[model samples]
Target chain A: MFAPVILSIKVAAIATIFAFILGVFFAHLLTSRNIPGTSIWETILILPMVLPPSIVGYLLLKVFGKRGPIGAFLLDTFGIQVVFTWIACVIAACVVALPLMYQGAKAAFQSVDETYCLAARTLGSSEWKIFWTVKFPLARPGIISGIVLTFARAIGEFGATLMLAGNIEGKTQTIPTAIYYAVATGKEDEADVLVLIMTLFSFFMIFILNTWLKKKNYKVS
Target chain B: MGMYFKIKKKLAQFQTDVEYSFDKGVLVIQGESGAGKTTVLNCISGLKTPDEGEIRIDDMVLFNEKTNIPVKNRRIGYLFQDYALFPNMTVEKNILYGIKNKPEYRDRAKRKELLDYAGYMMETFRISHLKKRYPANISGGEKQRVALARAIVTRPRLLLLDEPFSALDARTKETVYEEFFSFKASLGIPTILITHDPRESELFADDRIVMKDGKIM
Candidate 1:
């Protein structure tokens, strides 16, 4: 039980990192005027956040299963398996958590004054440098909040991990999966303890994030 | 330094047709709201591509019908009406934002010169104490000073100020104007400032261009 809990936390952390990076890129792309089909791409990115997690997990399995095109390529060339592994849990968590990070990052980036960016450009810094130095710094609060939210969401993920990675005890069984296992086997006391821990952890994260956001004057709107 | 701009473009609510040349002096653009002064400045700085135009700064052709340079290559400093300072950055970071990544000069000399200039301007404008404050923590007048400091820090070939004093109090505006002229005299760089105040134009401009309905009137 202890091992699964620790492993779940690690998986959630890694998944949050991946989602946060991709979320920043996607937010920038969505807001940039030069990118074509931005609206369509944004809608697709948000689908995972809105649609049922079970649907998302099923879709992931179809695309990344052992016989699927990408899965087959990975197996033949890289000798790597994706489905029913810890990696699958990470992938599932990232898909579910992407929209939160993207929304937060997009709002943060958009809030930066265009004139500041223009000033950087006029000073001879390239586009990449301007983003890293000026834009990213100004948008730090939003990015930080986004990371926290993504991490919390990934940690609480259940349906997607179950469908994609399965409840392999001490391997892919996360806190939520462990709770589900405990309840199914009529282990009421164990289930209660696990649920209490997960709930407290989530509440603490959210409370801290809210306080930080308020102190930094980060409005949700 | 000198710049020449000839642009013709159509927007949803307005159209622009401007042709002008600027030399090393204060060239003021005066007009009512929505008169396309900002658009003209944007075109000159390569922030907006004109459908038909040519922009030349000194010997370099910044924009022509056949060649369009990006904004980063234009090397033209701009001061927005809102004094768009990064809200999350300290004044030091805001001022150093432009020169932070240049490979040619990464030491403190340029930064020192800029800070010195900012200090002089702050003393001139009485904003010396606000150097460490963030944009959101400062007043409108302080924000304008920081914006001005940031704009002129890089010693741009052409400095464009768009409605710079519109957001300030009268006293702050006067102080900003005084600091501006002193800075202009020191740098000797060509400047094109936008204003709706006839008195401001009369006081500061060597040549005043009146823009009306997107055309130079």
Candidate 2:
């Protein structure tokens, strides 16, 4: 009864952690440097958010499929498989959730006063120190909200997870996949229960996010 | 012991071409909005790169075509037009921040000495009472003093002020100027101040460079 729910929570938590790390690093990179073709890079990072989930799933499968380059390398090198597994579910969730994390962090970093960074530099602080002490703290509220959004997106992922990891019962069946299965099989009672749980979970996360942002005097316009 | 730079940088509207050197006292760069006064300070502090130039503070080469020292290693203290106080830190923490990451701090005795120095700076700036207060709660003049304290706490080789008194009122400006004069007298380092206000210029400037359309006159 609770296997899918527990699996969804685990996948979302791990995916959110991965997204947060990549998102913060990429956000800092994109904003701090005068890299040529920055806008194109930003657009590429953002593509998964707008692309069809099935397309994202298809791309993931291609990269991680047993016959693909990366997949074949892993198999030959380490005797590991990635496709159609719980790991693939996590990968799918990370891809879909990453854009949210990236966009949020980028905006947060951009909003920080450039002068503070310059001031820190002139005060004999290394670039690494300035980022950890000055930039990160000032941008914390926005970054936290980004993390929450990523977790929400991760747990709610469906189409991509179904394509990549499949709807294997007890193995990779997340909340969304389980709900779909219940509805398609005409198990209306089971579907209703799962829907209630998912809705309540999402509402709780959003509620926490709103409260935190408000406490930090951040108003969403 | 002096600072020298001959820099040329092309802006959207004009090209900056200037050559100057300053020994020990305050040198004021007086100019209008588009005269590239701030850009000069940015170049000296290693915050911005020039198309062609060599910057030397005393015997150290801060910037040249072949070599550019990173901003942190340049050891310049800069007070921005906006103060740029770390909004997340308390006044005391902000003042101490400049020295906290210094290599000297790795030594236990040196760390204690720096902390003592920070306390002295807080007392000197009259921010001892506001030690726990965040920048958002401090007044404009108090913010400036705190910023000044933070800048000079590192014992920098040079000091750069970009209209440091622009935000203060007449009364606050007078008090802040007095505080700055006392601070400057003690440091004995060269100062480059960019300000359009003639009164501010008259108060602290030992020498004045007039800039018009990015050219020194």
Per-model CA lDDT versus the true structure = 0.83, 0.90
Which candidate comes out best when scored by TM-score? 2
Q: Candidate 2 lDDT, tens digit per residue, B1-217?
A: 5989899988898999999998879999998888999989998998999999899998889888889999889989999998988888888888988898689989999999999999998888889999998888889889998988898999899999999998888989888898888887877878999999888788889989989888998
Q: If you assessed candidate 2 against the hidden native complex, which CAPRI class would it receive? A: medium
Q: What's the i-RMS for candidate 2 in angstroms?
A: 4.5
A1-221 in candidate 2: lDDT tens per residue? 69999999999999999999999999999999988899998898899999999999999889888988888898899988888789989999999999999999999999898988999988888889889998998899989989999999999999899988999999999999999999999999999999999999999989988987787842211
TM-score for the A chain of candidate 2? 0.96
Superposed Cα deviation of residue A20, candidate 1 (Å):
1.0
